[model samples]
Target: MTLKLLVFIHLLLLIFMAVGCNAQHSPEDFDQVNLINSAGPYLGLVVPNSFELAPLLDPSTFIPSKNVSHIDLSGRRFHVGIIADQKVIVVMTGLAMTYGQGEDDELAWESNGDYTRDIGYIHFANYSTEESCDNLLNNVWFNPDEIFPKNGIPEVREHAFWVNVSETYYNLAEQLQNVTLESCINSTTCLPTTPKIVKVERGCSASILAANAAYKNLLHEKFNCTLIDMESAAVALVSLSMGKPFIIIRALSGLAFSNLASKNAVIALTKFFELLSDKPTNGIEMYDK
Candidate 1:
């Protein structure tokens, strides 16, 4: 063969290999047993105050017909053990707080005085007085600086699993301290004399922008996957930027304080678990891939 022809063939082979490496995984390609085992931190954020996986704890309900042990990480729980001779580990983490009366008020945001209203941008204005804000900042898990220091980054355990529910929106709201007039233009009405609107965004919806921006910075710093659940786009962005696989699963619990039944929380959990078991639907896997 001519030397030029040989070089061309080599280049084609390289291209083929590169494409093969980046190819997406099909349902058939994933071993069902392997997938179940690989799934970690089936994190469920915005979980109801009464939420409980006690059913999972009951071997009769859904525990695989193998060695499956359940561990309760405070409110975060999961099943770990071998299933069908394959090791299956599932971790479930609750949201930062629950929603409802007599719940962790720190995690809950309020619009007027009642916790029923959506307290979007208001969190920024109320952060200093919010107890939940203090807990989140001081909490070892939420604060990256406390968990992973700047000087020496600790090695994350390959199997050490963690999952989050849809709590990022609230978390972001808690973090945002100030808002400029430019960002809130149409969504909010402001006076020209003031130049800036002091109105709070209620639910940390405004914080989403800032959180996603910060996530980008974190991604550049490290290659890791960050899975953000529904209402947790900000957290997901941070995880995505780090090159980490971020899986977000959001269950529609209910509209904010619309007299919705508590049963909705259970239904949301069911839907979330269904999503977890079935192949990616509604293009949910696009971000993860």
Candidate 2:
């Protein structure tokens, strides 16, 4: 009787130990809402500043947990936040163009005969916009122009050699209605109470240019842009590739060729906040998987 009891006890202990080991090695559910990810399906907003995210997120509701340790993009820091019960990631797209120091800066080659600074936005294509991991396993993209009707971002039909800006997003004018442009001429301090959100059917993004002043024709006419920015085109490409809905609201800075020689960063920032704060009724279900 005593020997049988000992065997039973030992067998029970072994069974318990095996169960514990399996639990310890079990995989984690990445779908759960956490500091680094969204609680539900998500929307991606690629903008330049934290304030820019305000239109979609409330500052007080921010999780306060910084998401700076992505293994793939460890060096690059990103912030994750929740907005309207959806996960939203804000990424700042930096400058898109650069060149190397050589006799012919455009045609410089290294000892290995590779172009210097050849690795531009093209190298890490989609690097900045990948922060928001909201994509359906299968998605059907619609013509943004047909759906939104206002489709404000730039539209480039034929690709240019040095320029690759094309595509469009929702209309900022309609989504962010009743915006008025500032007219505080001769001084930056007294900006208009409301800045205009110039929605565009066609626009372009490129390096800072004084084409407006030099050409007398609207610089936008020269580049076919009603809007211009350093990173809009690349951001558009990123969102479109992911099959997620995207929109851009650009506050009208001084005309590219205007005599002001100034940009109303405040207008852009404020308008972004206003639009985000005013939630839209329209949105795509990028998480219906």
The TM-scores of all predictions, comma-separated, are 0.28, 0.43
> Where is model 1 poorest over a 10-residue stretch in terms of lDDT?
1-10
Candidate number achieving the greatest lDDT relative to the actual structure? 2
lDDT of 1 by residue, 2-110 (tens): 0000000000011111234555545543443244335432322222222333422334333442423443323444355422222233444323322332334332334
* Cα lDDT computed for each candidate against the true fold: 0.29, 0.35
TM-score of candidate 2 relative to the true fold: 0.43
**lDDT of each residue in 170-251, candidate 2, tens digit only:** 4433544454444555555544454444445654444432222332235455546545455555544433333444445454
RMSD of each: 20.0, 20.5
